[model samples]
Target: MAAFTDATRVRSDGEGGFEADLDPLWTVGGKPNGGYLLAILARAAVEAAGTQPHPMSASAVYLSPPDPGPAAVTVEVLRAGRSASQVRARLSQKDRTCVEALFTLGTLAAAGDPRWIDSTPPPVAAEADLLPTPSEAPGTGLRIDMLDQFEQRIDWQAVGDPAGELRGWLRLPDGVGWDPVSLLFAADAFPPATFTLGSNGWTPTLELTVYVRALPAPGPLRVRQRARLLTESLVDQVCEIWDADGHVVAQATQLAAYRMAG
Candidate 1:
């Protein structure tokens, strides 16, 4: 099995460009996961800039779904300053744009003193204590296969309930350590929190922005996601990813369009 880093690896294509093979193991349903695609673009941007700045924030807009094959990532440096670099990256397949993103890169201090804060990590059960989802039969579809890429222990008590909240333990398959880049994928790995409110059908993300706060410790990540507001056709989700040591590693907010069953 290819490690997550190797699966999402991007190679230099030439000046100001890079190329990657989108592995099928990262696809959900029939489309590649949005966060996985964003990580590819972010990696390209960081390399093109040559600043070695860690990914601080990224805002991505998913235009279309790219096939699980070779894709081209072209990056343009908007500004490279002493503190940060801003770049625009676009992933195109067969000359058609699939995803576009603006990335902000900056160095993160390993240690810093915070003045005040009110956020706290949510309580969740240990990974071994949670129940595993039932195994799917052969040819069950690519979604199940994609989920298998990560170890997820969901809080079933919150699922299908009317709390508009979801909590769980999530981590990459064993051998893949946590990194800032991978947090991009982790931010969007959970099922839509809107499902708890009796909403069903595909909820496609229109836009997603993730903020990386700190490096993660080596263990399963604690994932907390909830919906703050919902309209007839839209939902706003907020998520926080806490490292094993109970520190916030990343946070994300996304706006998605809710599609009802026909």
Candidate 2:
């Protein structure tokens, strides 16, 4: 199996656009994962800017579910500054746009001293000590093929009674390196935290925002997800990604519509 990096690699289309093969191994419940698609678009946006800035922030709206196959990414640079560049990217399949994203690219500080902060890392056990989610678990429509690509250990204590909160340890299979791009995938990789609240169908994301704080170290990442608010049919999920070194690497918030099984 190819690593996630190679599977999501985008190549120049020779016409100022980028193209990539959307592999099914990254799909969930037979649809391409939004974060995976966002990573693809972010790659195209960074490539279009020609500045090689790391992904600082990305806001994406998923218009439709794209099939696992070839897709085109068109990028338009909104602004490029000395320290950051803003760009928009569109992902199209068969000439129908499926995903649109705005990205801010900039160099992350190699080392920094914080002035003030209030957030704290979530409590996560060692990967080996945590329980692995069963591949055939009920109500979890996760594809085994996709699960094979990642190592996930659930923190069942935090997930008590499906109150829309979950914490876990997640990482790619060996040989896949960690980067800001991969962090996008990690942000949305878990099953919807709302599922714990008895929501039993696909929760499709409408809009997702991810902020990259720092480069991750080599090891499993601690992911904490919780539902901030759930209205009639809409859910707001926030996720925090902490690297092995205990520093927060990325944070994500997504708005999705909840569906119930018939």
Candidate 3:
């Protein structure tokens, strides 16, 4: 697994907010990626909770285009309960707020009743292989931005391959002692389903959400994703993160607006 590193600079303002300058190379399509900001806000929430079991659910809203330059993340602990905790964070670049989020921490109880529901898992290939290290792969320009966090396998390299819908496995570098939320971090950036819309064009994400049932262990984390174009700007993609054992641990969905670009 490759290393995921960012040159993020952080300092606390006298006022309960923090300012940080995260590296620009990690941005998506030359815009600051959501995972970059989510990680920072979550780190603050995690520290605020001080050993809380784990976060139950977290959501973020994208309000403006995130600048690839330095930005700020402001966090506030809303409430800490004996059984749950809440926190809010907002990400800003210069004077504009780009992302906002709310995080929840709590414990879970065993299901009073046990029942099984229909669910599907990612498909396996008879001999599926990992794609080349981003630096060694073909193509250039915007696609290069994907190199920072994912390693994909083009199952067939179709005409609409990376366009609206796509299928492939991904890995989050083994560094960072293996963060449990790394899967959530991975899920934060879901591909646009209508990749085919731009199979000959370009599309930008409107927003993204991830639900982490679990995360990869401290090593190479595998992720499989597929995107489907729902409309011109309303595209959706779903992905599942799995462990080496072939268990689905985290799932994600994304919304994006499509456009034909140079």
Candidate 4:
């Protein structure tokens, strides 16, 4: 099994460029997971920022789903601020643009709590009280092999009788811990909320935006994914990840193209 760090590693190829191998393990329905792809771009963006090591905000448009292979990332520094830096990154495979992203890189104050907050983590059951989802979705045709990288405990009852929301718990393997970049992956790590609505098959993300709020405390994350709206051929999904300390570590919203399974 490839660790999250190893799977998402990007090496410097040249000035403003990086090289990475898109691991096959991080795919959904044989295509790279959108969040995983965003994490890859985040890694490169942070490194290119020189001093800014965290991706504060990232907005990506998925042009194409690249296969698992060597991919190139080229980053352009848009501006360097006193506290944050902005950069644009592109991931391409076979000379075709696959993902284009704009990232705001900065550092988070890891010690302080939010001054005033209106949102809180969902009331998910304790990890011990939830049922584990299988790592492989064999018959579903979704091919969520990406689940192999993390430990997940899902609320099956809520899934069976969803109330406009899907809840779960997620954590990295024994060795890896959640960081800002990994939190990007966590934001898109859950089963689509559409699953609770009797929708199936691949929900290919058209656009995804993630905000990394804070560094996670050490433990399994509390996750809640909900559907905001759905059209005949598209769906809007929002996901939130709270750390063990009950801090909102990351949040993401995506628009995807989907078809209801017959």
Best-fitting candidate, scored by TM-score: 4
TM-score of each: 0.91, 0.93, 0.76, 0.94
Error of 4 at 151 (Å): 1.2
Clash pairs (backbone) in predicted model 1 = none
Best prediction by lDDT: 4
* Candidates sorted on lDDT, descending: 4, 2, 1, 3
For candidate 2, give the lDDT: 0.84
lDDT of 1 by residue, 1-262 (tens): 4367887789988665899999887867767788899889888989889885678999998888898999999999999888899999999999999999999998865423336557777878778889654224244332444676778788887564438888998877655667888888889888788767767646788899999887788888899989988988999999899888888888999999885544
lDDT measured at residue 174 in model 1 versus the true structure, 0 to 100: 59
Model 1: ten consecutive residues of lowest lDDT: 133-142
> What are the Cα lDDT values of the candidates?
0.82, 0.84, 0.57, 0.86
Candidate rank order under TM-score: 4, 2, 1, 3
Residue-pair clashes per candidate: 0, 0, 11, 0
Residue 20 Cα positional deviation in candidate 1, in Å, after optimal superposition: 1.1
lDDT of 3 at 111: 19
lDDT of 4 by residue, 101-188 (tens): 9999999866247988788766887888886677565688555778776787887766634565888899787746789988888888
lDDT of 3: 0.57
Segments of candidate 4 deviating more than 4 angstroms: 160-162
Off by over 4 Å in 1: 110-114, 133-142, 160-162
User: Residue 24 in model 4: shift from native, Å?
Assistant: 1.2
lDDT of 3 at 186: 63
RMSD of 2: 2.0
Candidate 1 clashes: the total is 0
